[model samples]
Target: HSLHCQHPNTNFCILTRPNTHTHTHSMVDCHILLYIFPGQGAINPALQFAKHLIRMGVKVTIVTTVFAHRRITAPIPEVLTIVAFSDGYDEGFKLGDHDAQHFASELRSHGSRAIAELITASINEEGQGHPITHLVYTMGQTWAAEVARGLHIPSTPLWIQPATVFHIYYYYFNGYGDMIRKHTTTDPSCPIEIPGLPLLLTSRDLPSLLVPSNSNSYSFALPAFKEQLEYLLDTETNPPKVLVNTFDAIEPVALRAIEKFNLIPIGPLVPPPSLDRKDYAEWLNSKPESSVVYVSFGSFVVLSKQQMEEIARGLLESRLPFMWVIRETEEIGDKLEELEQGGIVVPWCSQVDVLSHPSLGCFVSHCGWNSSLESLVSGVPMVGFPQFTDQTTNAKLIEDVWKTGVRVTPNEEGIVNGDEIKRCIEMVMGGEEFTRNAKKWKALASKAVKEGGSLDMNLKAFVDEL
Candidate 1:
């Protein structure tokens, strides 16, 4: 027999449920299949969300690429099953080495077959496991919903980006593509006003995908998003329910912007403070509160040597104790050797833990949605050095809307220099305004996750449907 846990809480989803045999009624277990984006940024939040499901007595099975599954170092959370399907890249898919378009097509073809097999196998078991009753997919995972459709299970997309971005993309595909292109085609400084978004966005504030001059516009992800949104457009009676990783107080306007979508803000889905020992924790502990700079560009971004050197110069100039995560070692030079001596320089660390540390005053980041949310919830301000896709949009949110950070711009040479980095870091760290805003948002985020809070209420409502 499956686990029929009886632990109860004020929150409904946090309680465990009875199995078919335990309950005389016809109610079966609710099993959700979460198909996640393979990247570290996407995988972490999805896992956190799954943990909440398990607490609620729901069964969760995560399906991801074979390579991604192997790369995860953490012990898999108890009771949540992790399953892998090949993306035809059993080893790994390096963007620099592989073609993105071909990979997306292969993931769709192979993933669909594997999911069908997985679902079928579960059905055959007698009180062994539960068949998937609902499907939730992340970015670039629209094809999973197609499988859910064929299998007759309900599906919803978990949009990991800000709700504002989802709205921009919806507007683009539905009618505003040409007008947006016209506004962004020439100067990036041109103002492009999108309906429903309270603020007028410049091309700088837009996703690089919508900007014709930006390199990201040429990538396969744009088309993948287009396909995802287009499929949602055909529904008549029911508006597509999109689960976004943002909270109400932070994105009150954006959440209510689109009537076409039942945009559910069940997030700031940042994980709780980690208790695991970090090698740099002791050093961070020694520093004064809100005195150190934390720098990371997430897993994928590779900056030019000139830019890296400039950043190194700036951090050194700022004269703050710092922790920098430098993944791409080949492109960097000896300038970072100095960084390792006085500061902590590693390939990676527990980012959520680091950000939440009291010593962390400022975050120098790529403005990835995960990173941005983590920084905000941790009560840390930022110096945004964004690159590509949703990073630009998130940077705008950080600097303009949220008032919790500053952004750095590249000069004529297409590089953000040491001066710019130092300026932003010093500004963010020195200003009480940024820190105050960060603390304000952090408080709201905490309230949202408390029992019966906005995020908790939304997630509970969704779970109730199951």
Candidate 2:
């Protein structure tokens, strides 16, 4: 008997048969579907991984919001297929904190169901020659699991941040939210050690969301945050195998903590930039090694006006020629204008190209996991100024565990002044010990991604399991 399923929105159909009589057949073609999250940083890594898998002969498809699909300018690989969500794409939607949270919740509620139905229809339309063999999804969108379960396919959850953030979320799940809140706001200076985690961290080392305060508009985000945490802890029906976007050498402690869970570490997955390396080389050819400080905060971490001024002043005070990637939102008029008068402020430079530049020196960053790993791979020391999310944890790994960077302490108003910023940047760039350690990490990271490396073996194991 054959069963047919049709999509309401598109001319797509799927036909299937319930097996009764068995017959020998050759190996069936497999389709691997990746569900990408909305964030740009998240989308980049998903695209990188999809491209890599496709090059290795795995058929890959991406299901993301229509809005995101439009923002990306990079050429899509021919072997990879894109399936946009049903929500109409409009780039102009002004989403507030509450609206963003509501949208996330709605996606969790119905987004996966819509994508799954579409996949069924598309497969049927293609004459049922290939079936989806596996589904890999980003965290926070629990709906992907529904589709994977419905089709009896293995589902993997990709954690785009360091596993240390997961440890914090686990603590929150076990009724430690108040503890985290107290540490981040009331007594940020005190060191708090989490059980099974490697390093002792202070309140300021946790994500800003866990920091106690009622002033911000993120109060609406609390529920969604809690919902995501609950979903992470839920291991029964949605037993997702985990894949983290981090190298083993960068966060060994966090990696050790999640060892018992079915997890794979395959990362520093940054693709080389499209621009010619010689162009970047020509720009940096005159500079001295360990002399230039490269600055960039990840996409979403916005800096206040005061913070921007402080950072600008600090960079000027350091008296170092720097390459800073300033987002339009983070530019506080005269602060960046003034900095541009002194340093190079490119709106969006190719980050990997910048990092790999021969004359590039120190990285002054928010310590996002991606940036951190990139710095390591490039053999550059860092000056960590963590802003939010997993950045706090990543900062600790850089400053405390790796000993390749220094953390700038914010003042009473939660701001790091220009002088302190200058001091940290100068120290990381000028200190021989820091440079030596950074180069060591760079060597290790390079070896980790090579054939027979730890991450390479882990990737092989992951594909083998699938």
TM-score of each: 0.92, 0.85
lDDT, candidate 1, 359-383, per-residue tens? 9999999999999999988999999
In candidate 1, stretches whose alpha carbon ends up further than 4 angstroms from where it belongs are 1-28, 126-128, 328-330
Give the best candidate by TM-score.
Answer: 1
- Residue lDDT tens for model 2, 204-292: 67765676752444454456545555554564454445788877877676766744355567886767656655443564677876567
Q: lDDT (CA) for every model shown?
A: 0.81, 0.70
Q: Number of clashes in every candidate structure?
A: 1, 0
- Candidate 2 versus the native: TM-score? 0.85
- The local lDDT score (0 to 100) that residue 389 gets in candidate 1 is 88
| Sliding window of 10 residues with minimal summed lDDT for model 1 | 6-15
